[model samples]
Target: MRADVGRVAEALVEALPQPYGRWSIAVFDDPTPNAFALPGGKIGVHAGMLAVVRTPDQLAAVIAHEIGHVLADHSNERLTQELAVQGGLMLVDLFADEPGIRRLAVVASSRDIDV
Candidate 1:
């Protein structure tokens, strides 16, 4: 974690409306301009984004935006939706005796997205 990012994470967590857990910031070496946050306070910022972001405030904006997604419970909603869909399919398989349905369920359950 970069010192600057560590500071930003601290400030952001402090500013957050509710209590948050330990957060980690990771700066990737890749050149693509991108950033995302995952559950449990894991934040990843692409190295390329640093070139265009220009200031700590801009970077903070990006971090805060990602954190907003976590705060909104988008990830949990998606997981619930996926599970419902997969469960339906698995139920159908129970009647049809299709082994492939279990494989599909595994794949679906493993799917995830960064916020």
Candidate 2:
């Protein structure tokens, strides 16, 4: 864990709307450059990121962006959207009057949806 990571993360949490848990920041010794902030306030960094990000400000920027995702609940929003689509397709599969429409719904929902 780095001082700048803790300092920026603590500062950002103070302005968050609700109470957040104690934050944990840790580093993984990997060759990939990436970082993530989980729902429970656990944040991880790949050691290789230091080579790519260069400055403390750059690292802070990455952490802030990931924190924004957790704060906004973007993951749940995406899951809800998928569930709604699946439910709509299920309803069509059960109740649609036209066989063609039902088949289309089934085929659409079964396809590999790359989001």
Tell me, by lDDT, which candidate is best: 1
Error of 2 at 10 (Å): 3.2
Give lDDT tens digits, candidate 1, residues 37-59: 77777888888887778788987
lDDT of 2 by residue, 2-31 (tens): 556677667777777888667667777887
- After superposing candidate 2 on the true structure, give the runs of residues whose Cα lies further than 4 Å from its correct spot: 1-3, 14-19, 81-115
lDDT (Cα) of model 1:
0.77
Return the lDDT, model 2, position 47: 80
User: Which residue pairs collide in model 1, if any?
Assistant: none
> What value does the lDDT take at residue 111 in candidate 1?
52
Residue 17 local lDDT, model 2: 80
lDDT of the structure predicted as candidate 2 = 0.71
Worst 10 residues of 1 by lDDT: 106-115
Off by over 4 Å in 1: 1-3, 81-115
